[model samples]
Target chain A: MANTQVDQNQVLPEYGPVTPADIRRAAWRHNLTLQWSWNYERMQALGFMWSILPILQRISRTKEELIANMQRHMNFYNTNPAVGSPIIFGAACALEEKGQGEVADSLKIALMGPFAGIGDTIQAILLRPIVAVLAASLAMEGSWAGPLIMFLFGLAWFALKFPQVTWGYKQGVNLVTTVAGGALDKVTEAATIMGLIVVGGFIPSIMARVTTPIKYVREVTVDGQLTEKVVELQPALDSILPYMIPIVIVGFAYWLLKARRQSPIKALLWLTVLAFACSYLGIL
Target chain B: MTYGIGIALLLGIIAYVAVVMNLGASCFWHEALIVGAVTGLIVGNVELGLMIGATLTLMSLGMWTYGGATIPDFMTGAILGTAFGALPGVGVEGGLAIAVPAALLMTQLDVLGRAITTLFIHGADKAVAEGNVRAVTWWHLLGQLPWGLTRFFPVFLAIWLGAEPVQNFINWMPEHIMKAMRVTGAVLPALGFALLLTMMPLKKYWPFALLGYILFAYLNVPMIGIALTAVAVGILYINLKEVRARG
Candidate 1:
């Protein structure tokens, strides 16, 4: 995250100061359409440009300067909207205010990838799955706590907007130095550990609940009297190891995804076919 | 007529909000759980909505749109699924049958939405060349149109066109086929969990995963219980590592 090209001790020339009001305005729009304009060509360029327009407007003296700066930002820009984008927005604001627009552009291009990794790990992998699964489990049980939990968790994201922006604004490029020190990695490590454990729990409790419907029955005459016998495969397998079939199925799917490199769509189609065939055969 | 139209309109609004106003952390509003719950509330069947939504959530576990990738639009699927399933004799599995494939198909619309927004990006590009800052912002704002429309139209038309045809389609489904669909629903979640496992650092953390599996399978510890224990272990792991670093 640390770039040697950026001299840490270089004193910035003071220009139009980016006000708190400008930051607040930018933060408000952060939630609005940050990814709505995501295109294959430039990704989040339009939305990212739109979000920090207020800050750029306030910091630039001449109309020409503002347009030029906006055009610079409109270049290929994409990152996780929550954690990554805000820091970049703040850093951009800080640099634009000092009229160091070229450095800002280069830094945005450089840092977007790493921040995206961090943000995706945090938001997509850990938080969304854990919270949504927790809430979904509750929802499955017919508790109103499902939506209530989701709504409450959403507020935490909303609350993060202000401080994240403020921190980015305050730290500017120094934020990269802090990230380079490996703190974000620690956070990612913890999250991965927690996510693995939680999702591991989900494998058996949720996915492995798909029980087999197979059963075998027999009748025999013993000592001149009729006797009946019953053998249930699901319970038999469960007694040996609970959720054996489900776990095997999940493991196979994992092999397909990782070993075979099958697309999720293809895997899904095949699974649907297999499920129907197995059901027709009374295997599940 | 009005009853159907009102619910359709509400769902359309929700669809628009879910996709456009991602709100930083994406707010998980686009997740099936929230969408399904909201749809359930609108269609006067929150419990059914949540149940179907949960199923879809599990089915969509590791399916995230990272770095401009488009996954299935189960959020919209949940809305239509819940609304149609809420009808008499439709049932949850019937909803699942329609919703699952519909969602997979909806990925194209998501791609289209992104492409449509590229037009707005070009609009912004033109505005930038002309030095009209306000116009650039306007182009950015107008980009929301395709995103909103892509989600809204499917939800609105599916509900507005009403559920008679859908219900008939479900009713006409053979008993064994319905049974197979139910089985498919049950087994498909394995793919989701597997996807999560693949995405995770399972090789490094297999021990914790085993701990979780054992706790759930043998001891019957609940999910929250396992989560709490994991949190404690995580903190302990981090602290121990820090101590080692200092030494």
Candidate 2:
């Protein structure tokens, strides 16, 4: 939300004029530092670090030039937040030195939300899940693979981080321009494809029905043997159907809170009470 | 050292509380390792504990956080279920079956914890205004304590105290009831997927969704492989369009 409204009275802290050479050197230093501590602090610091990139890009630029700079910086930032933050900061610093303000500030605000979303998805959803699955599966088999799994996962984590940093440095502005023009669209397409497959995988993994309150009405006899072919009836409306009840209730509550403009807490509270009542009344 | 039900349950409670509090860096693996090791120590099967912990972690691989929201907390479920499942006669599969429901039940606690955190955000603001860094830290920490405890202690007590009775109940449960639980386990993921799908902007990308589903569900292609193929195809499509525009 922070924009380029720099107060003239407030003396801006000087960090010297940014240059391509300076950016490249700073990026390498950042990369080395990141390789040291891959913890939460590093991650949080990375967020703050990348946030300043667009501000630099906007200084002293025409509206069109500003938009172009914004798009380019965002592309680099979007690639990977943890590693990309310093690279972006350096690039922004270079732009700031070049006196491009409008481009930098606009891009900063526009890209923050998307960058955060992408970073969380890649780290939490894709990478972490894959590592957890592989490690856990191996561990379950009684193999002394716990340490091995951890090491391998850590390797993959770094493997994914460094390339983005190098790419940002080598390509610089070209990277952002390329991404804005066509590369980003391709990435989104790929993300969509990957997301769909993940969803499909989740179907069998998460949403397969567990229980129905249906009972067999009659047994079929096949060649003097009783076959378990019985007509089942849906349990009377609800017996607190575990999975289904939660989904419907959450959906309704979310709709009320998000779409209908009801207070979120109020909606959640009401839904919880309703759920409890339905359970008590033997209807869910 | 051989541990009893009480000790195992206590460990579960502790692990749950620790994660809920955010006292340390607690991921699913960390939670499982802590709980499983404790349970294993109690049950005289530290090795088994590690194995079960690892397996459950894998089964929950795709579980993640989007924005600030996370998939259900599988840590307590994994630990308690594994402990229960690893009883004298119970095996890993049995433990898994029990753990799955326990994990599902813990979802409520997770949600509640987040709600509590929302309250603390205001307190954090107040602390910031007062320039009381210590007060702010304490408030945040205080806010997380209940969240952590609820995750650990209550569930620990429930599993520890109720294990024998629950196991007995399971032993006496009708075949149909067991079948129902299995069915519930399988269907739960579908609901999770549904939740995820509903939030996605798929109107313009319907074909990709269909293609992915078909490839995975019917054609039985690996997910990663299919994803790679889609990326390749998309790159080509974009390039072709670019060429046409230039021409």
Candidate 3:
């Protein structure tokens, strides 16, 4: 989507260094409050400003400068917390320091959707679940290390904080400019494929255990005399395909979600009601 | 169980507060095992707590609240469920059964918690007008209190009020209804996957979805095994795309 084709030899000009104190403070608060204070009008504006305050202080000479910078940043911003790299935000800080607020703002907005896409795919869809499964499995085996292991992974996110924020600052706008390159797209696209496959794989292992309660006592003539036989339904379906009922239920949910355009809440309420009613009647 | 009320209250608040303060990963703090571990420690039954926590963790496998959507409140469910599970005769399954409905019931509180944060947002607006940085900062952080309280109240009550009524209710539930509840519990997870499916930009990824289904349903592969397989599939797809693009 980038027309200018700003290549490697270009060596985009760098903004002056933000003080060490500013970087330290900003990086520390980066994860804080950003998850909450998510408002309707501007999702993470308050938290984003809170994160960059120290840098704004370093760059802006006057009260007017500070307020103006804060107001500009207070505009709408929402992103997946994990995959929306602090590097991107760091680059935006550099842009603002170089007095390119509008450019930085536009870049932030433009990058959020893709960041959310790739971020959700990797962090939400892939890594988090895998970690949970591994840790929980370990816990189930009577290991105290299970909870310890999970907490350690959580701590690993902090390890990402310093390196990324500093890298974004060092790379400045050059790194962000290359974000539109084909490489990131492939990463995102591949992640999408991986995510879909995982979701499909999980359908049976996780959700497809429902079985029917219906059974019939059938009468048949055997050796010229009446004979009674019991026929069952759930096992019949299971014989054809394991988790068949679950697949059908999940498929129905998909149809309801997409074709009916129902909200997740409404769909959940409906499913819960249907499950109870059907199970009550011995239909499933 | 010596430090009953105080410890239960603190841990419950910690679960929601940690998320707001960015002190913990949203994924980590919200997991049942973690919540149960803390609550279990409070009630002196860390072993039962861990198992109950692990059980709910599996139930919630692969579910995420992407785009900030509310799902069942697993944290509260774990805390309260494990507290009850700590009692005599209540095993891990019983704890999970308690958790299933508790998690469903707490979704409303999750919504209310988010709604209450708006007042702080408005307070931040006023802080901005006055150029009061302290006001802006504190107000934003203080919004977390209501969310913490939302969690704390229910958990404290469940533990403090005695587990008799809740246990009796579980016992009083008919065999048929319990069967139905379990059936519904199994189906509820599908809604989460479906929400994600709708959000995914499937484009050319549809075939891979079927491939996953066949691998799991026919082959009976475990989740970890399927994940490794997906990595291979993802790499192959990327490689082919590059080849076609070059040609």
Candidate 4:
């Protein structure tokens, strides 16, 4: 009834109808168990299938088909939750209706790895630290702008969550990958450089601070006269390398973590113990 | 140190809702600043909340749970830290010290909570076999129960039953011990940075990391300055790499 003289020759493709409501529901399901139901067996398979359940209902011909698709989607799956899954899932929905079930499954599996890389580099490794550190620095300074700023950035990034899926669906793999596909590696590389720089800057400002108040208060004779001169050791160290001890501490931690391949939790435990011991003995 | 019954319950509910946000991909509520801000509001001390949250944020700067590997649960710590830290004389530093262990311990709880979610996943599987779409949705939401309670119980205990002992412990800690904890707190971020380095690897970016250190450590550039410098470098690198790809 609502059709305004639709052209008879339009010949829409025989694919699953992706309404706005379907996308909305899919987005909701995609995020529902994002951080919650992650497991060893199937990382995001459960949640991934759940997100497209509404679409499956609309597209599948039989109960067996729906169950089969659901079971297949439940296969080992994982991705960077922010941008990767939505894009891939959107394409899968499109392909599913086109009777390219195997292609859809393989595509979902393949696309996740690179997208995971991009998402991790861009969001977790790059954007998170920059925003959180800035907010933290400001919060440390007792400014309300800290949390406010972090929230705004976080909100903006989140706003892109749904759009990623829709954009992928509309453009499909060819155009979408062409646009940002080649850029993933480049983006990941550039993001790594930025992450390193940020982490480097973070060490001295917040991470490491080793200072001692023990002043060299020995009596010295100058020009045959008895005079007492005091030189504090912290300033001396600072002159050579401001926050040098913190740098050394980070260096040691880096060695323990990377070269020795020590567990991070163990390293953290050791640091805690070292901090207590250092403070007790005044070595740090 | 104390809240009215209504306020106490309300705070518990707010904290409950906040961790629920973690159920989805949007990580807004779990951020240290946001958690701190929430608790700070409940306790009527936004400054204390920001301070506590900022401290936790720095400590957790490098933390990201990759491949379902469990890490310290700082979100719960943030809530507890701010709540306890807001008390008179308890202070932000002391509360942070308390929060440190809380976060580490909560990692175990987080892992267990995720495991419990498997039961729900199984239910969803069964629901799918039965063509029970409604049941599948319910099961999915049911899994969040353990996830939500993992956060809620800690927060409730801190407010309902934990305030007095915690506050007393803070008041009882000697000044020197507090000083040591402060030192420890300052040093904790090193571990976070170390973890980040391990995950990302310095690789060819070692120089950029070094430059970052120099900019902040020697030249005294602010964090934003370093961030801006890094952004410029990233854009330039991207442009150059894109051109190379085209070539």
Best by TM-score: 1
lDDT of 4 by residue, A1-284 (tens): 12335454442232246577876777777755654555433446667777777777666555555667666565546667876777887777665554455556646644554466567667777899999998899998888889889888867777777777777666554533454545545545665677667667766765434576667787899999999899888898889988888887778777888988875556766776887888888776
Model 2 lDDT tens row, A101-161: 3333323322333345456566667767666666656666655565356555555544554
Alpha-carbon runs more than 4 Å astray in model 3: A1-17, A173-284, B1-4, B21-27, B163-247
TM-score of each: 0.61, 0.44, 0.60, 0.60
* Best candidate, lDDT: 1
- Residue pairs with colliding backbones in model 3 are none
Model 4: per-residue lDDT, tens digit, B73-184? 7777887788777778888788898788878767655655664564566566677777676787677666668778767766676677666664575468576665665566
DockQ of each: 0.30, 0.16, 0.30, 0.30
Clashes of each: 0, 36, 0, 0
What is the CAPRI rating of model 2's predicted complex? Answer: incorrect
What is the overall TM-score of model 3 with all chains considered together?
A: 0.60
Worst 10 residues of 3 chain A by lDDT: A7-16
What proportion of true contacts does candidate 3 retain? Answer: 0.48
Candidate 4's C-alpha runs over 4 A off are A1-16, A31-36, A171-284, B1-5, B25-27, B163-247
True-structure Cα RMSD, model 1: 12.9
Candidate 4 residue pairs in backbone clash: none
- Lowest-lDDT window of 10 residues in candidate 1 chain B? B162-171
